[model samples]
Target: MTSTRSVAACVLSTGMAALLWATGLASPASAVQAVIVVGTPSATCANPQHPTIQDGVDAADAGDTIRVCPGTYNEAVNVTKSLVFRGAQAGVDARSGRTNPARESVVQPPGASTGFTVASGVSNVTIDGFTIQDSEADGINTLSAGSGFTISNNIVTGNRIGINFRSPGTTSTDSRIRRNRIVDNNNSLPAGGSGVFLGGGQGTDNLSITQNRFGGHVNADVNTQGVLGGGDPAEALTIASNTSVDSATFLVLINANNPRVQSNRISKGPAEPSGSAMLVDANTDGAQILGNQITGGQGTGIRVAALFGPDPSTNMRVTRNTIRSRTDGVLVEALDSGTFSSNIVENSTANGIQVDPAVAPVTPLLFSSNISRFNAVWDARDQTSGGGTAGTANTWRGNVCPKDSPDGICR
Candidate 1:
């Protein structure tokens, strides 16, 4: 009889290329790249040749497809070439009760190793639809000098970090991490970890993290840090439309430039010192925080500070957000040249919106058209040295509040 691999290749050469192209497994430019299957043969993946995912990856050329069947893989898969690794149920939500052992591809890394590591200089790699867990380190880690990576639709939990992008010298750009369930990935606490970490020595550009669910993290759900000593900033990073709960911090942007965080639903941040719903700190600039729903956090709903250095958080636009917290709804420290406008802040144990005087001379901030009420402290309190005055420094205009620090601040 003829061999299975040869028969599969012959079948792929005929009309299977069109099917692969239609399913986004292969592009038109690489239409003839073979599809290597791992695990037992099934209706979707016929002629299964490799017993392990690493074997399939080792046999596949660049731009080939590795289709993993429903099974548990207990090994570290390292990818050096640009290829598409598709699990059995790619793009299906694992939280929807649709994931059964008969159709789930799970990767549990043995010992302290990571589930998957996209090596340096490997670009255009896609890893989709797999439950990767129980790793002491990151579940999925991408090294320096890579771009165009798409990691989507998987359950990543019980690891030190869910997904990590570490670019040391060169910059990684144009990566999309969407539609995944990342939970409880803070197995290493106190030492530091996050659900998704974009930090090594350098920062990424045009990185998009959206439409994900995150919870139970020791550190922030999504955390990004720029170069250590400040060389180049993480530019054009977008964190939008995600739901995060019960994390130490929901989102943190440090040394980032022009980051847009919008339309996220965050709730129940921990009562720790780092448990803010959002923190825009350090040398971050040009941040757009808009249209988020924050509820019931013991910590501040939103905090803009410059705690690390003398470079104040500047040019931030915080607008149209609904915030209800046990602490201050919005707190500003060492912030300069920002607009806090059109937000509804209520039911806070402390001030609804406060500008701390500890960072004195918080100048050139515009507070306009906001509704703040039902707070224990003053609804709007600007305690900077020259604040709470009409023409002093910080401008509070057209605000609807019950009470304010200065008599003339509420309208």
Candidate 2:
């Protein structure tokens, strides 16, 4: 897919300079330009007589902000310029029904339908401090290929998808998805929707999913589910340091290659119900699963599998994470080569590490320096690796049993 320049990308270049200017740290222009505010029927707007969020965005160059007021604005906001769209106060619902025009008439046109539509490939655009809900497709849909954008400090609920990065074929990289409280985005689909979805088929790379609370159920079909999307296989992605609770299927499904899922706290359906915490399926390789604590899911904590029959995983690392519950801690199968080291697997009803023989004809699947103690089942089961020889090739060195490990209290 040939990448296109998104409005978000264009603005991000100038947004950094604007940030510097806003901080009073640098003087890009001769004189400091006063902060501009937009939106109508208010005395505080830059042009109290004539102000619209779109107008402010249109007036802004690269480094600028379009301050949106508090209220229900039933309008689709599109940004072609690079800028920050900030709310003066929190709980600004931009879904439907304008605020009482007499007291606080929120901006709602005669037939405004959607909440926010960020197109024109504007990069580095930060939409903050609002309660955006009940949009047509997504509350905030960034279809443009832009980087360095932060959709933070907002309460996005009752929508199809909280934040949708529809940038498919753009070189939109280095974006941050953080600090947003996303919940109940199960409006459109019956099985519920993802709290946040990053990247479409247009090739997004170097994205970060950090420090956000993603809740609500996502149904699994042949495709589509989980917090992050089945991203473009060509890009390098990162899903780290986030909390995923009560998700139906995989917390984060990675069809993309070279993605890292680290340090995230994930809890899913109860053990009796059976839900896979993370499912890495189909043509994925070079992934790193490190330092994540996953619990209560029915299936494996981390499942790495090929969508096809013949291909194999290579040069991957699953290290130093904590997995608890009835699920297997680290399940490695069908990989040509990889390392599973220093992970603490406990309380699992199944084997600590399940290396499936169904995938690859057993060679050595490295299992070293791991702590598999207190698990309700065997520390390590060689059933799936190979009958006997295929199991021994796995180096089970420096593994402390439940009775002897530092945390010596076995279940």
Candidate 3:
């Protein structure tokens, strides 16, 4: 009753050079170092990367360590080198997005995106504790200059794109896509969608997207379009503590730079249909919005748009976020400079900050200590910085809204 490929070819012809001399990937005059095994572990590791777990990471090397066991293996794994795959339980990396009705071990069809594809000059890799499911595009795809990596405690699900760090030709730098969990990834087709898409081909810089848990049952769009137009200049990004629900377009920063979106937790699920939840479009520049918390979106939670496509620049520093639902919690249109502070607008049907059309007198916009409440309509609206007039110059300092009457507008 030995079969599990005959006890992995009898432990790859006797401990494969003592497990490649205890995991250094063997250099002892090379015996063609080959030993691929999976499941039913008799405990072993050495030149392993392909007894099927995506062909032992295409025949591993570069300090290999592909040691898996505990059943369920369906394919799609492509780490180029500098490996360290280990998933025998954390989610059972065979794409388990759940599907019963006799689909027992359901090979593929939950979010469908496959897994692992860290190509381009691969660097120190390390994918741990698996549960990647139905990936037709992105379970993990950090292409181009694969730098020091470490995707942890995996559980990525049904995909169009989950973890994508691109830079195929020129610039790809310091990486550390962290603590994984990304679920029901943007699976609405259209090139797979986007759960964590960071395009390549433009010097991708020091990225450190942390503590992941993007969108519950995400129908489409979690985090993509964060600079994927040109080449070189999408620097120092650091999105933290993630969590989104029913995201159709949670975060989109075209032509991005110096970002730091923090403490995320977008909402919209209970069977979503309302779109646009956080779209900082246009040639977005130097950002630093903090303490994010957007909630119950039917549409438009926080939208700051401009640039239309061909490279433009500005400066931003939005602070202390907390926007609420029903639509338009924050929509500061077009830009030149920014510095909103201590934000916390609630119950918006529209207009919390709907200031569009500005390109004159250089009055770029600068509000302070914002805090509008229970909005049913205009708390602050400017079709064009007061020419179209809903609120002009927009100072409204040290704000608050008991329903507005101390000139903070809105009644």
Candidate 4:
């Protein structure tokens, strides 16, 4: 149980100790401590040592390192205070001059649920390098918003919800969910099993879901929808450089505000009855959908519209994206304001760009500087209401179509 295995970080030095000590790692008052967990160690893994991971966490101080050796910790670790639960190969080797990868230790719950939960009121906690699986609920549930969490380099699979960021009533939480392999969280029952779910009612500030693999045997890879509660909308959510494939519903379903959905590879696979590669719903205040490569098979490749919602989809900039779809390449409807420009839309059977404002008097949109081709239907269409009277003042400027037959409000 005490055999050395490859892991995440390294021991802090003199300068580093001072910084982390103020941050509560290693100081004269808050000494840097290590609690080791072996399968069958002589001394019980308590504050300084314990046999179980949870025991070490419960006994340790606010700033301690529970260095678990390579063994299947058959229990859920509930982290209350700010601590680091790393594996044997968690840190770097200063003597060897090589960075060792984090321990691929297994953390399957023995009796309770969830692998590692950063409990409420706990900030600056890190859950790195563990194989967390088979939970009745979420794998790692950051129970509420307004807390800080850094979850990196872990394999989270076979749970009802992978990483559930439940934020209620517009609280601001800072989180970084990067470099994790979140997969195969299958829940046939309704309202479960999303790879990364950002629940409604609250706002997540300084959120970064970047460079993660979110696909394979999941319902929705990433689903983000927050309500317009008393607090302000989520500011600066960055979902970039992730690869999502074979998702049953919505590779990236974003109904949040001011999100930067850039440089993601999304494929709307599995062919569910109702789904899309991407969806930006009516509640979007301002969004930048740029530089993405979306391959569609069943539903719309990129849909920016609302259905019977009061909120206006305004100030969106959808540019530099390559959308290929069986349905509309870029569907915009029921909006008050937006701009779609410099995009390459290709369709095999549907329209490349379909602008249909189902609202009264037609919420005006600008379709400009785009290229549409190879669509069976119209290359660029505007099926707004009332022939021309209702769909007035909507501008279609400098667009290039192969057939040269532009429809509705194209001047």
Winning model by TM-score: 1
Q: For residues 1-411, what per-residue lDDT tens digits would candidate 3 score against the true structure?
A: 211221223234557878877899866453233324444333333333244665565555566566665445666666677777766543333223423322121123223445677766787787777666676766777766666677766767676676776643234446665566676665656566566777654545667767766664443444536455644556777777777667665677666676778888777853576666766655667788788888876777777765446444457777889888657787775666667778888888866666665533244466677887777877665554442123465455666655542244332
TM-score of every model?
0.88, 0.73, 0.38, 0.80
1-411: candidate 4 lDDT, tens digit per residue: 332223435666888887887888654643445444544442322223467777777777776766776556778888888887775434321112222233346777753377887777677677776667777777887764435677777777788878877533334456788877787776434556688877645656677888887776445777765344424566668889887777755444344678888998877543644456777775677788889887766677777666424575677888898987657687765666777888998864678877664633234566778888888887877656443322444667788876433343333
Sort all candidates by TM-score, best to worst. 1, 4, 2, 3
Residue 378, model 2: Cα distance from true site in angstroms: 4.0
RMSD, one per candidate, in order:
5.3, 9.2, 15.1, 7.0
Q: Which portions of model 2 miss their true places by more than 4 Å? A: 1-34, 39-52, 58-62, 89-114, 166-173, 190-192, 220-236, 269-274, 308-310, 361-363, 374-377, 384-393, 400-411
Report, for every candidate in turn, its global Cα lDDT versus the true structure: 0.81, 0.61, 0.62, 0.67
Least accurate 10 contiguous residues by lDDT in model 1: 1-10
Best by lDDT: 1
Candidate 2: C-alpha RMSD after superposition: 9.2
